[model samples]
Target: MGLGKTLQTISLLGYLHEFRGITGPHMVVAPKSTLGNWMKEIRRFCPVLRTVKLLGNQDERKHIREDLLVAGKFDVCVTSFEMAIKEKTALRRFSWRYVIIDEAHRIKNENSLLSKTMRLYHANYRLLITGTPLQMTRLLDILEDYLMFRAYQYCHIDGNTGGEERDAKIEAFNQPGSSKFIFLLSTRVGGLGINLATVDIVILYDSDWNPQVDLQAQHRAHRIGQKKEVQVFCFCTEYPIEEKVIERAYKKLPFDALVIQQGRLAEQKTVNKDVLLQMVRFGAEMVFSSKDNTLTD
Candidate 1:
């Protein structure tokens, strides 16, 4: 998961600042646990950009807004998805150049208020960053497609269509002058949607384990509408857990089974005891295995 998504986000922000001359108020929405991580990344990469973290209660939000509006004071604003939903009214008041959604999968549920709130806001540019873009279900695919390309009408061509037919349709739709509605940086989720004529670039990172994960990751960028010859970058390190997970997924094992196997392997390798114990506890909970089954015991 340490795929430099944060660094890429910072680079995009820097590009906007330097190339596009976009110094307007910008916002980044991420999970609560990652707000500090984002701030750290921004400071490390783009120190010149001013930032305000939206946290605390009503008064805190007011203060954040006041500080942001001050003439030439702050350039960017960062907040958690929770806060963004809570303070949607206040957030909409400020005109934003870019609204970046980190772990955009959080809003994969199209019906969630978080997704609704995000869609309501007006931003000159919207960027979504995530390692696992299609975590929940195929519904996520639709939502992300809409968000990235603003696709108004989307429907499966046919469930029984052969790969050749599917490719032909995608090719036709992705032809030049079709629509400039969507740009995708997906992994497996984009395989069915990848248009070589439309996709600009793709970057692949190596970790260890799952074929499904690997397949999905590649499909994200290797799609049909990609007009330019795709550029793919693969990154790998000694840590092989990610690769292991991918391999297991390819074997058709349930994710839970793979996790248990991984845990056992880690324990065999003398991995952290606490982490192992945590995995054991997790497994016990999954099977509802308990030391004290009786309510009073």
Candidate 2:
């Protein structure tokens, strides 16, 4: 976990400014807890550039927005997910040179309030930091990330319930001890930004393509502000595709699942290339050979 990502990022920002001649009024959207570290690193390493921490009470934040938007005073702005949404009216005014997100899982679900609002911020270059592989060489690596996010909205049904309905659900779910509230929600929409900390348990009625969405659903109750220990449950039927989803996730991250879920890692290996080809061929053959929806294994 301690991969020196912050140091490396500060290095890149400095390099781009000094040698590449890309003097940026960049934006960094990070967790409230880590916004200090982002600005601190920039100051400690790249002190020449003026960095502003976009936080404060409502009034202070309003003034900071004027500085960044109207005055265009700072070289970089470090803000949290909440402030990005709250300040989007001003944040949208200037096109950013870079929009970097720390712990990008915050916006893993595209239609979530914070996720959508972050996009309204125009950025010439976008960056996301996740626990996944980090290669500082690629700044445009965010294009794949952007595609994946947009694809999720199209794939998840309840994720499309944008605007007021989504806000109402978040508010209701965050209330302390809301009894008899059976919130039927999509895996993506139910996961991001909302303070589901008061929720005692979370039920994932189905899985999403990215295992991250599945993990996000379970963490809804596991976050800060929760009164009781949270329990997470996921259900999948006998479908082959459903079984494959879980198997692949556990296989890819056996150690993470072991600690996080308190489950043992099943002995797993890579699927054979020939076997994968056979599965693909079988699906194609079934589609052409029969009208039946079920493919016989």
Candidate 3:
């Protein structure tokens, strides 16, 4: 959640206005919880860009729509998803230079109302931002189906979960004799500001590319006051891209330790083309040569 998507988007807008001469009527749609953060980042990074928020009751919205929302007056308009939907008609009146959606997976399903409404507007360019990748979201869908078929009680937390709702979910899961059996969460969101000391078992259905993130998720169940010994299980396939990813994570752990214990600055590491090629080609030969049928359905 702290990967600087907000700052990156702000920089892009600033570039467009400063260099490209595209002083837009750009629109950014995000969750209600993040609108403040977005505004703060914009003001801190790009004060020259004019901004407006489309929020409030009908009268207030009417006043903004009638007065402050004139095109050319503002460079960026930030609003929540609810406001975007409610004020879609008025918003559609502008020929937007850019339409950016934060946590864009909300519209993954084209049939959903939000998706349909987003497409109704006109924008020269559209950008979608999300911490969860496409494959990760699809995997979650499969996990949901499996959990539902097993009739297990579970809760989910992602970028869109508000602070109150997130706390309620954690409290429910941690309660004594609670029926909630599993807590499904993306590593990025779950790795931050969560404590589940009552949990004794942590099953990592997937791993984050960053080893520290995976460690954080494991610590959620292994917190202080836990009576039973916490057990962590990490899921990984052999010789695929993930195997290489896990290897890279392990290599970085030593450097991370140095940074933590010795106050040494750790250089930021990135995977290059050779490593990427190896990751892509890692298991190909084995899969093509094997004759075994692994399917069981």
Query: lDDT: which candidate is best?
Result: 3
TM-score of each: 0.50, 0.46, 0.49
What's the CA RMSD of model 1 in angstroms? 15.2
Q: Give per-residue CA lDDT, model 2, range 184-221, as digits (tens).
A: 55566656665566667766555665667777777767
How high is the lDDT of residue 97 in model 1? 87
Better of 1 and 3 by lDDT: 3
Q: How many steric clashes between backbone atoms does each model show?
A: 42, 0, 0
Compared to the true structure, candidate 2 yields what TM-score?
Answer: 0.46
lDDT of 1 by residue, 167-203 (tens): 6656665666765343333344444554444555544
Q: Cα miss at 203, model 1 (Å)?
A: 19
Candidate 3 C-alpha lDDT tens digits along 185-278: 8888777989998888887777778889988888888777799988776676875466667657655665566558553333425545775565
The TM-score of predicted model 3 comes to 0.49
Q: Candidate 2 local accuracy as lDDT?
A: 0.67
**Runs with alpha carbons beyond 4 Å of true place in candidate 3:** 136-297
- Of 2 and 3, the candidate ahead on TM-score is 3
Residue 255 lDDT (model 2): 37
